[model samples]
Target: MGIAGESVAVVGAGIGGLSLAYQLKKQGKPVTVFEAAAEAGGKIKTLHLDGFELDLGPVSCAETATLKQLLADLHLEQEVIAAKSAVSKRYIFSGGTIHAIEPSPLKLLMHPMLSWSGRLGLLRDVFIKPEAEQTHSDETVAQFVRRHFGEEAHQKLFNPVLNGIYAGDSEALSISSTLAMVKTLAGTYGSVIKGLRAEKGKLNMSRKIIGIKGGFIRVVEALQEELGADLHLATAVKKITPSENGVKLSLHTNEGEQERFFDKVYLALPSYACADLLADIDAQMASALKQIRYPKVWQIYCEAETSDQVFDGFGFLVPAMERKSLLGAICITNLFPDKAPAGKTLFALFCGGDRPYAFEPSVEQAVKEFHSILKPSLLKVLHVQEWSEAIPQFYVGHKKLLQSLKAWEARYPAIFFAGNYVSGVSLGDCVEYGLKINSEKGSVEVR
Candidate 1:
């Protein structure tokens, strides 16, 4: 069946699913979105408390072309606001204090965080040569960094930075898949340093970090408005069975279990959720998806009144070697002063990534522990949110799993998959993936 008149069913109402529905609707296809939650915007939830806007998830996003286009398509260009210049001032905690990350190479040479050997190792990156041949083989982020910049650099610089991004271990994450941009730079210019130098101007121009004026939920709200009655809430897909014509979905709703047939079915949930939905239809494929692991994360939003400025910079990251209870803290007020009331500092404390199971403490207990580490004068916890399985880990063999999933998708054209786990985890990646899935002629082949 042709895509224009074909019916499409999208499971999950997250950014990925909603974006896919929007794209399909733009193509004049009959699209319907099913969301298990009462509301849309899965993890992009924002809270308003005491006249302050607190984003429970994803404080900011790196502005990208696709994201810009999405905002334009949603008529949200006027709502965009660039982050303050101070947002670039990130810090790292070491030796019981926070230090600003030096921007200049000369300043880095005398940086307090790095030892003399580590400084020397960083300078060696320019002299390092990239691999001659490109292959499908993958290496851990730690391994890749050590090979090019030396072990000290990996431990001091790469490890903590990557931990903040993935909430994962550098020793387990695939460098080629997780840090594809860095790998591409290394491969293209024969050295990361050389590639960076060549693209310095372009990188600077593209580094604008932005957020919505009200909150990120505005984007979701706009999409929902555009979709109107096509979006369904409080609905879950229990089973998915492929059919000769297309696909059959068994949905569990408030009324009862219902059956629906569509030309194509798109799953925009996490890997495990998708695995469960497709288990009966494709056991092996579901089993492969079950292998993907997602780590637990606890986010604590707090309001503190300090007589003295606690620290400068956007936030500070704690390396695993520090043995601290907290992963890191984002100075939300510092990054965007408008987020909090005057004279009050707001912070979002994060914990429980790749940490020991024993570290899973109650919200109050965790806040008390952070108080000891942070040492703020009057810190009060405003809100706490826990995600049992938060960020997905792009483990060592992730590439092979992706290849297998792609092959399965090719075999069954009626089913499509889109999620953070499938592509990069950034919001931009999800939106871009949704927009790119359909054919150039605005239609997807229906089996």
Candidate 2:
């Protein structure tokens, strides 16, 4: 398919938008990307302070095949760096203590994190049959885990782990939206454990977590270099109007307000922002987009005064049931030695999720609360950052919202949606979805 006269406008310069622009450009399509921020790589911010390299957003990326191919295509394979094996030694906080998450199955069976009964409950998953209704219906992650593994497993094992990833309440998050692959496994095999056992050899369980040597910002820089004049910075799209053959975008630039028309427009923004852009085009579509919710998150980067190491492993997640002020914490220096100078320990503390501490706090208040909860010996705060609407929470009815989005795209063929909110949240998910765009058809099919 050839797109000779057709032109595309991508809003937002996040990974999704940049990757989509790159893919569309490769297909010989005329493309332009508009970014409100001066720099690209939204939510993938990197900083250098106190002689330590810090990543405030995503710390690492899973070495998925799609990501690997993307790096290869960009000739960035040599820049890739793998985290230390010690990063795999994760931990969980429970009962006022941190317990190491053992990787060995035998050691995990006797792991102190769970009681003996809870350990046995995991083994019973192999024999437990998936509920017929649950296989077809959308349910909370807490409900699915409790039914299959038992309450102890749900509380002790899954809750904190899920919180570390989603920063969401297990009782409210939809399994079908967050862990759709796992849900499919259970629904297909009638047992999640059985499904895992059957696909043991086929699964890529040993994939390494990786990052660029310098920072993820290099990715956007590379894309921008290729885009050249096609990339606009510090330009915001104020309004969008649909036309018979294309769309009209009103932009707010440094000079003045301007209007431009495009054959197609791809919104790679947050659901709420997309809602605002499409409000005039279709009230129903805008209403559906408004239904999506995004949670606020505070990520604090701190350097410990003591040279002595903290608990080894990736980090520990605090279960909401524990009623702790912290959502989780990651030992950045422990994961990648190059992140900080030798004899210096750096940690990234995360708070504010679906729990009571969801509101943003002053730097002093956040430091005080963090000290009270973590009790790190003589902690020195390096950076305190907050993302007001950071991660999108895939609530109980997220799947229904996705279906509605699909219908909206069918009705409005020239306006397409692509973002972490529409697909999975991982960088790999966004990149893969971007690569799958059919520029000739002016449509994006997000599976």
Candidate 3:
């Protein structure tokens, strides 16, 4: 499967695109990546202000083997660094208070996040036979959760945390696709607690849940350097056309319209962007791609250091039932001590996802709203130093929409789709999927 004279064009220089490029280039394929933005890394952008490290998108990567293999292949194992404090634990906001998410099953049973009734509800999952339809249905997460767990679990437990990830309402997100891991756990062990205990032996402990030593974008920079001149920044792909020989692309650059042909094309763009390009190539696929939904969120980063303040732990997630305008608050300082200067903490705030009623105001509005959430507890002077232009959204119906997109790929052998919008939203998952797409043939299917 040497690409030799065959050239592969990657549409976006995000993790997915870079991973594909790296894998293909390794396999003797002539690979070229086109980035619409002035720089690569896509949503994984990092900004430094007043000596504070701000991650506009992802804060950390999960401890997984897929990431280890990917990074090891790129020789970035040494670059990985864990959080400074062992208190790098997630906090869940429930009943107007925050509680650390206990890691162990015994602690989880004692955890205050779930009420006695909720705990009982969790036990029911062990005896409850998984619905036959649920095993393979393409339904929203809300449906599966409400059916299996109950409304309280759906509202209090899954919604907020998932909203933080997808930034879309779980009610509309595909259950089988978005939460495949959970489904696997349920189907296999019939209980999350049992699953963790049984599968712990198969896990690799070396890959810790952390970010890069410098910043997440450092990984992107390293990938760019590895790819060398093969990476093209500030090149926007306008459209992709399927030809009898291969695939033709129309691109927009400062120099003007450019046409390029490739033996294969990997679209690492957003679902909507993919729809736009596929419209001329495959109308049915474009229709299904257009159905994919994405919500919008506004991320605001504030740099505030106070020797007097005592906010501990990684971050806090807000449940929709709380009626708070903020989705959650991450004490970036606790996650990475060096993220901010000494005595100062970096507070990252997220807002606007799933709930339309949630206010999405200016930096002033978001900062002011968050002040109310933190002020009562910390009672400190907080000031926002920076803000992002916009946040991404992974909407409902994304799974079925992907099915249609892949079907189009089946029809067009040389065309493929890979991105956060397609299979996953995590940096690790995106990278893995990109490499998988390159290695596999026929149709692009995620299962």
Candidate 4:
């Protein structure tokens, strides 16, 4: 294998872009990272407001193998602060109440979240063989779950859980894109339950959620220190031009506009951002990039400090069937005690997903709904934040967009797209994709 470039330029300072820049630098490659924002860490922001430490973005990492290796490589293992065991636990709203989700699927047989018929239907997964055509087909998650686990499970169990991750409706999201592992099990072992039983070791069911010591900002700070001057903060990449020498970046900084050359350029920005950059380069590529969508969400952080107002465990998710304006709530204090004061408990309440019928959630609406879910005597609303362009949606036919991207990259070769739009929408997924980059080849496939 041979390196594609002597110098690499990474656009956007999000987790994905920074990870790529870090990997390229580690390989002894000259790397430059450009971020339009004054600070790095795109979605991994920690808000310190009114004596409360709230994580409006991702609160924990999945502790994947690559993340463990990353911490070791960075020699920042001390930042590996373990969360309370209860942080792994989650609850599902069912029958007008919240029920704790069992750690194992077998336990679902007795879980209150499912009706008698629905509970019994889960057993049938061991025997029912999915349609052969669906093994590799693009299908809606709602159809996939109903096909295997029955309608009740699809509504009560699958909807909220998947919503927590994708912030979109399961009926609209592509099953292969969202629940790929479980879907593959049905195609491979003839039954999802059987596949799970046979592949327990590979699944790593024992892995615990890893919360960073001081939200995710600590990791970004470490990366910033590692990159030093190679990282350009408050610098906007205006235009890109490809030539035989390399790609020239028209960078706009406080110092003024200037052109710089790089052997290659990797885009790790949002889909819309990417589309804007490549609109003139290739109309087909720009069209494909625009096809990807980012849904909006409102994350409201509040706390209840009174003894009678305390809420524990991970948090509860309201199934869409509940028809509530609230989506879910996270017990921030339970997960990271130091993030909240000793007497105070913080919770990140969320609403405003892709449900068209629902009204845009106001702070008042969220507060009332939060009261319905978790009643607290002394409810204090700390802050209300909205990400108009939140998590990327992987709707059905998403794979087609990915294929088109590959085709475009094949034609261009000098530029590649990365980040949450192409990554798996997880702290670990983005980091892993960047870490796996073949700096030797100076290219990494998003798929």
| Candidate with the greatest TM-score versus the true structure | 4
Superposed model 3: Cα runs more than 4 Å off: 69-75, 85-88, 103-116, 130-136, 189-200, 203-207, 305-309, 356-365, 376-397, 437-445
Per-residue accuracy of model 4 over 1-447 as CA lDDT, tens digit each: 137437889999988988878888888888899999999988878888777777768877688988888777877788787778778688886776678887588798898767899998777677766565355478888887877778888888888987788778888888888888887788888688888888988986666688776668878888888899999999988888887667888989999998998878899998888887888777777787787778778888888653664555788888888777788888888877888877778888888776535556566786787786666776888887888888988989887887777777777777887888787899888998788887555566656
* lDDT (0 to 1) per candidate: 0.80, 0.80, 0.70, 0.80
RMSD of 4: 2.2
TM-score between candidate 1 and the true structure: 0.93
Which regions of candidate 2 deviate over 4 angstroms? Answer: 103-109, 120-124, 130-136, 305-310, 356-376
TM-score for each predicted model, relative to the true structure = 0.93, 0.92, 0.87, 0.94
Tens-place lDDT digits, model 3, residues 1-447: 334667888888987788778877887778999999999987777777777777767777775666778777777888776765644567777875667775564665556777787666655555545454345455667676766666766777788877677665676666666777666766776665566577888844335578776678887887899899999898899888788878888989989999999889888877667889888867777776665555556677776443444667767787767766677877877777787788776787877666645454355555666665555333232333332322234444555566666666778878888777775777777777755654547234665
RMSD of each: 2.9, 2.5, 3.4, 2.2
Q: Which sections of candidate 4 miss by over 4 Å? A: 1-5, 130-136, 356-359
CA shift at 2, candidate 1, in angstroms? 2.0
**What is residue 47's positional error in candidate 3, in angstroms?**
1.6
